[model samples]
Target chain A: MYEFFHDPIYFLTMIGTVVFALSGAMAAARKELDIFGFIIVGLAPAVGGGTVRDLLLNAEKVFWIEDLNFLYVVIVVAVIAFFQVHRLEGKRYTLLMWADAFGLALFTIMGTQIAMTYDIHPVMVVVMGMITGTFGGMVRDIICNEVPFLLQKEIYALAAIVGSCAYLFFLHLGLDEQGAMVISVAATFIVRGLAIVFGWSLPPYKAGGSPT
Target chain B: MYEFFHDPIYFLTMIGTVVFALSGAMAAARKELDIFGFIIVGLAPAVGGGTVRDLLLNAEKVFWIEDLNFLYVVIVVAVIAFFQVHRLEGKRYTLLMWADAFGLALFTIMGTQIAMTYDIHPVMVVVMGMITGTFGGMVRDIICNEVPFLLQKEIYALAAIVGSCAYLFFLHLGLDEQGAMVISVAATFIVRGLAIVFGWSLPPYKAGGSPT
Candidate 1:
């Protein structure tokens, strides 16, 4: 069990949380939500995964319940994004994709680490990693009235899974926790970033085509 | 454990599922989502709770996965709602409130029963009941780009909690399972219905003059 105040992992988790909050606020800005709505959506992505994780593990309190800093991060990021939106003159789609990719990678590694600490099965850990990485974005997209990218034939969740697998493999090879986290996060970011840059996608499943 | 087929409770659950599907489809119609999107939203409200329950309980498969009839119900309701949108002109708010209340009551009782069968603690069962009752609407509201009513100081979740308390009380008083369920569902429906009709609400929490 990882204690919140004393653990080095807490700082790493906070980084992931802040990044997720920024991405969520960015998404909410695209939807033109009010300040309150933006804050809510931002906090959802920042803390939603950890909330679900704690609930499933039957932990005493949700992460954000214990750490008001996470809430502060979400609120501050949302407030900053509201003002920064006009200054951000770049292509919206490109910025969104990059932010989302970074958030996905960071959250996936953090989720895998937390699940490992709980001593959950490896397969379950991979699933949790994917959930942690993708669910926040899924909620954000749904709240923004867009189709969730995860449901599309994309490499997004697949990249998270691949990175989680890498983490598991490193653990099997007796790598230290911090080393595994660095490698896994890097693997996820590279895989997803390359996929985005190269326009690479999983082959679409063909349905009801004429027999060849 | 309740068996899949031949149980009256199962039949009632199916009815509740269909009603929820109709409510979601009607909401989607108001939101002007396309046919596929409407169907997906409808199915979400219909099966989301059971799916969550199954996942948490580690059940063999999700209910809708094992029973295709639930899917058919959602599809049929969504199709009907889509084609009849123009003709179905009425007080949309009233209709939605009633339908949602019905679904909330039904699912809350069913969820409580299921949790009791698992020998879960009473407090946890109440929480599960509230989750089963309200999460569908929360998801629906999120997908529709609206703030979830649950997050508000609404009578919504309180109705479920009150009903869950009623169910536990009835059980303690030696009521039969069916009698307890009927009372619980009725309690929820009445409370929710009155709340909607009269605009009854919990006072917003005042922490430093802001509802925290």
Candidate 2:
């Protein structure tokens, strides 16, 4: 077995990259951006989270920089999606949400696992996971000048946090790495999916009784 | 002089941190965010850019995490500005703009100086400098759900890039580290200040005549 369970994790990371890139491309299309705009925005979420995770952990090298495949996949996916997104008609938002859900799930587990190598506090690990999962989309929203999905009442970062905790819990229960990852991804995906279909959200923060 | 010319750079970095935090806090005040919101938003612009730069370069330790002073300064400034911003009254926007200009100038030079140690291509060094100068405000604007000042029709990132190039140019011309830094900061501040006062901006990117 590889130390980081290299094969499966790497495969899922690529999938997450592709999905997030597609979401970004679709966002660009919605905003009526030019081709260069599509590529820039698409690339942001695709690599943003992982780049941040690697930075915070001081990884030996940033992952995409070390492996060109992630970059190629995102570029190809973005270009393809930029043209194809218009055909989705009204289904674009739905597709983007689902794509983001999977990206969130995969990245949350990947980030948690990477941070695990550093032997930091468990809370920090979870926060890293959430950062990895949410930052990409938050950046995408920022570029498009929309309120970030994470900062809104959406049940987004909470899902990543819960999934990160589940991964730790499963690992403690003696599950193998692959099993823990699988369960963790499913847990995050389900929570986020439910929120999308049902509109579940945290209450908006209301400032208390007029500041002194 | 110290290897990185530690004393002057360190003092300027702190000054940059305080100014950026004040800008963020003022933004929160404009948005009427709660005290917690003020701190969180304020902290983002204060540390966000350097954090991104450190991560990209794989710094041994993130600066703030290694030195608590930067973090403490941001928090204190954020809290103080949360209450004091209201008193700035009609001057708040002007104050925020000027503070941001100083932060941009300081951070651009600081980031360029740090990246110089890595021996990367000069272009990458300049890019890093721009990222360091602009990302904080971009993030603050993102959190507040406004179009990022960097992304819009503003002379923001251009100023950082110009300063980064000037730093490189001066150093290449055999100027000492301190001289290079001083000139670079002044160049950036003048360019950005002119934009703020005279409304200079890059024209909006227009998609070519209805894509085929």
Candidate 3:
């Protein structure tokens, strides 16, 4: 337990959790939800992805349930953000986007790493990584009643896929796990970061003369 | 495996899966999502609740993953509905509502039953039941970019809670499990059905001169 706290990965995971919580809170603010709504929405992104990943992998126990620290962090951050988010007004959207990107990057690497430990097919590893990185935000958007930016917008899941593949490639080349994780996270973050700044997005499907 | 299929509960579970799949596909049609989107969205409600319950309970495998039949059923139903939904244009809304109610009741009872096997508190069991019944529709609404009808309108989750409690109450009174499930399902379906038919809903929160 003592050694667990010292792990650098755990530090990054906490940061991811905090940012995701903030992202969810900002979304709740947009919806004009009550305080209870803020916490529920906030907790969605903070824990949603990892919970899904763990369930898919059939992990013995969910991480947050095993360690109350993550749950506490989400609740505390969300409550604080509820009081502070309104102050950001003009800048809240930008902050939320950046926070989501960072959360995505951190979660993508962590998920890919965990999946690798399970000895599943490499394709499944990348798929798990993407699910972990993207699912929480999707749930948040759904709860907020918006089309998930992940599905309709710029290369979001693609970025996670790229990072997962990059990590695998690096590991196959004998790169140390930590070094590969750092590089892969950078890969995902930079890709998503550039998409945000440049307004990059995939073209909408225009086939069949528009949907009903 | 043969005995598992022979169980009466499994039959209801299959009906629940089919209706949930149909419900999700109908939602996707409203969004005008393509076939791929139909499959993805349809799968959300069909398996989402059970998957979450299993994860929370630390079940050895998620129910759908353990049995591919559920996944296949969802996919086939979604594909069929993608084509058939437009035919029900005038009646689609009414059908969707009924489908959702049935799905809710079936999932609620199943979730409550599973939680009871875990020996948790009665409150947690009901909470799990509500989560199982409601989380899927919430996800469906979220994916469809609608504020969760569950959170905003009607006594959806409340119905699930009522059913869960009814099941618990019956069991405590020494009723058999199968009988308890049948009665509870009726309780939930009737409550939600009345809400739908009569347009019943919870009053909105209006504290502090409205939000935002």
Candidate 4:
């Protein structure tokens, strides 16, 4: 169980980190930020979740503090994105959107796995998953001085919740860790992708203009 | 011990919530947001810390959910600020800045206490304090399309850290809870206010251009 859980978690986290970093860099490019801004955005989205998680869990050190590779990955991605901005112009948004969705899904599953390792309850694990998946981007948006996507646009966080629920259900059904992760990530991606494609949104509250 | 902790915690939290709500509404008034935006900003800063804590702790329900008074306080403050914006403009920035500093101090101490209640380590508690104190303002700034003071300014988060350290040290000295709380909040406020007054700041990293 340890071997199965550990290796897959590491791989998924690496992939999610890279994808988030690239998407963050893409956002910085669109915002016309300089090299330093791009690097900060990229690094925040890549490592912000783990930083939050480690803090909450009272883990020994932050993920990036423990491993410089995460920082290097974000730096490399930001640099690449910065130089290739023109090539990415037309497809930038779409590419970043998809990458963000993928990262979200992967991080959600990975977060749940880590929470379980700590013996936290399933419901708590689900919440952690949502935090891990969405918070980095939320932080990124805040840093960029934009309304976080979670607050305004598509059902991004709701998708993470749905995936967490699916993961819990699969675990209840006695699926192996690998199988449950696959199902969870796939569910998150599907929900998020569909929302993006369909422009789905939660109903906005229609508060009257001014109440006398 | 439980009884000793209960009432003081509740009182401190109430004070923190009210001040943060007022500060947030004051910020919104400066930005000329309508009633709705004002209310949202007020509520976000007031309830944001407890909400984040509960989510991370996997508590049964968010603190605001358990006590609707938190929402009521924010709404009332927002409403008052909206109507009183004209008068507030006389000392708008000054009032808001002081209120923000007070809110930061109060919330940071409260958050650290809560984390300690959950048996988290001191380091993690300090981190949580910093998050609780500053993240709300970060959210408010983002919604207002401004750079977060934490990233732009040097001493903002550092003040919270100093207060957290002070709180821990007092606790180590076996001071009563109220003593620790007062000392911590006073320490944070003093540091932040001095920074504002004296233009004390950590040296900015040597960089060619503005980060933004």
Candidate 5:
């Protein structure tokens, strides 16, 4: 209990959880899903990434399954978001995007740290970080029958890669875990935020003379 | 090595891999995905479900990652599938559906047996079986930007459930592992095959006369 209270990762994970739940709720509302569907949507973004990460890493029981607090938060937040969908009508897209970016950043650092605990290749660790940060929203998008924003926007995974690398650099430089996490998370959030605001994105790839 | 050759589970799993990879390649061809995307699509249906089951069961490395044979089969079959897409144009849907049902049955029994190997609730084991059987096709559908066929057709998961129950029943009857697997898999595949041929379906859910 004391460790949970003092752990920065735990605290940030909670915030990310809530943010992701809201994102999921927004998608659910847009799809006009039933209560059961709403809850599924909410939970997908909140825990999908971590679940995939744990599975890929062959870690024990998925994080959220082991800790029910995360699902409880998702349920409560989803209920509120579903009821208030009418009020959040116009702002849903913007709100979902921003919250998603924050969740992505937090998870990127947290996931990388967890993967680094194992004796794996650094590149594999970085890919796992990106997967953990981005896969939840991918799950959300897929469930909602929408094209994944990840495929449409490269910045999402790119930010995760950069953030994971930054965290690694700080640790290599002998920075404390908390300090490294803070810096990388903040950097990832800023990059995504600026990209959203400025409409900045990498050019879409096209082979030969292909056009988008 | 000898056990792998003699094991019915291993042989069926290999057939399942090829069939699912072909199903994935068909979906990719329809979507006109690039080579990289095509491989991902093939790999998704071949490995996604086993990965999910391992994650849920908290098992050691997922089945595919632990064995290169599964991947090799998927790739070799997927390439053959991709090249033959033009020839398969008319037969794609029918062939994919049949192959998919076969894969589902094989995975369902295999997954259930594996989960039953552990000390878990019977109900949970059945659920894991359904998940392992259906999730790969779900992944393939999602990656192709289509609503999952599983959600549209309850028979997909239901077939797995029934097959798993059949396997359990046979085991309870003191049938050997090989006999139980054969009976259950054949039953599940036949059920799905009949459903496809007869266009058998459960009515879509609706409440208060609502329709999608």
Candidate 6:
């Protein structure tokens, strides 16, 4: 019998769910949303990326629908985190960034692996990985009415691209799934972490002039 | 033989795709994005809503994947509209609103019918319809760094809800699919069009004391 936690994807996904859900909850709290809104905010970042990825892959079902446990995790995390978020407001931004980085790494690896399961162009697989990593946060930011961090001059998606490409590279080098996933996750986290700590960022794109 | 144009869904969907794609392309052009960026923007609104609905329904593939013509339509519309959009910049917002209203009406009826086919709860079917109608514009607005029109003090989603409920009501009144569809589509278009013309809007939510 394959237990849930024994599966690395499942375990990492659960961890990602909790952290991202908490981040969502915190954002909702800051927005002064009601409980229902907090739950929705939690759910968006928890499962939104995978949902988009599954659609692109033409998968039969989104992961959340396939496994109700993920939904449960989102609800549980939202409730728990919403109550405690006020106390942690001072450090929430920094904490949210780190948690988001972790979630990005995990989701990218899992999405890349799943896309690889179906034979497709290698470039698309890498894109699927990056999409999976960044879209959740993008969805959250959009709903929160903030500028989507991914579209800004952030190194966020670039980090995911690096990790996704590394995953493919390891697979090409004959590394097994678990070995490749570990290396790729670490690579993404380190790069993204250094980006945050060292204020690394891409140059902002400037439209030549305002719209005519 | 089920020829493409024989299906009203196909025809309306194509129209919706083209208009929405043009809207997206015009937005990107105004932003001074490169050709590749314009195409991405075009594709976002062209299929974003249906892609989202398909994901929620756990469909085997998104509608676009089932038909490549949709992708072709997006590309063609993007290119053509990109060149001509500047000429109509004076009336672009009004034209975009009308096109969006038409697309919303068409997509809502079709999406509601499809969700009803899946035998989900009737309310969820209506909700699915509204989701399908408005999400594409929301995605487009988000990508363009504007607040999502759906989330603004706009009657956008409410218009979808009205059409979706009308679809369900007509279905309940023993109107067949074809009958209910046409009526529901007209109802949505009328309501959305009137809202735009009358400048109907909801009161913006105040976050208490105006940003502290």
Tens digits of per-residue lDDT for model 5 on A168-211? 98989999888888899998998888889987775442323222
Those runs of model 5 whose alpha carbons end farther than 4 Å from true positions after fitting are A1-7, A34-36, A201-212, B1-43, B49-58, B63-138, B147-212
Query: Order of all candidates by DockQ, from best down to worst?
Result: 3, 2, 5, 6, 4, 1
Per-residue alpha-carbon lDDT of candidate 1 for residues B109-175, written as tens digits (9 for 90 to 100): 8887776766455766776687678777677777677756665545777788899899999989999
Each prediction's whole-model lDDT (CA): 0.76, 0.82, 0.82, 0.76, 0.79, 0.79
TM-score of 5: 0.60
Per-residue lDDT tens digits for candidate 6, residues B140-169, read 888788867789766888889999999889
Model 4 chain B: worst 10 consecutive residues (lDDT sum): B1-10
Better of 1 and 4 by TM-score: 4
Tens digit of per-residue lDDT, candidate 4, span A56-134: 6555566678677788888888898788867977777898889899999998877777666665656667767777787
Reproduced native contacts, each prediction: 0.06, 0.25, 0.23, 0.09, 0.23, 0.16
Q: Per-residue CA lDDT of candidate 4, range B34-124, in tens?
A: 5655666787778776667666766555555435567677878778766665665567777767777888898888778767877777788
Lowest lDDT 10-mer window, candidate 3 chain A?
A1-10
Model 3 chain B — which ten-residue stretch has the worst lDDT?
A: B203-212
User: On residues A1-212, what C-alpha lDDT tens digit does candidate 2 reach at each position?
Assistant: 11544776778888898999988887776666655456567878998887778777767777665456766787788667655666776776787799889999999988898888887999999999999899988878878888777898889999999999999999999999889999999999999999999999887757985433
- lDDT at B137, model 6: 78
Task: Say which prediction, candidate 2 or candidate 6, comes out ahead on DockQ.
Answer: 2
Weakest ten-residue segment in model 4 chain A by summed lDDT:
A203-212
lDDT of 6 by residue, A1-212 (tens): 11224665677889988887887897788799988888899888888888878778877667788788888998888887767777776787998889888988888887888777765667778767887887887788778987566655457877888999999999899998789889999999999999899988754323433232
lDDT, candidate 5, at A86: 81
TM-score of chain B of each: 0.90, 0.92, 0.93, 0.88, 0.92, 0.92
TM-score of each: 0.58, 0.62, 0.61, 0.61, 0.60, 0.61
Query: Positional deviation of B46 in candidate 5, in angstroms?
Result: 5.5
Q: State the lDDT of candidate 2 residue by residue for B1-212, as single tens digits.
A: 11444776778888999999898888788799988898899888888998878778777777778778877998899888876777888877887788889999999888888887775767778867887898888788878887666665567777888999999999999999889989999999999999999998754433332234
The TM-score each candidate achieves on chain A is 0.89, 0.92, 0.93, 0.91, 0.92, 0.92
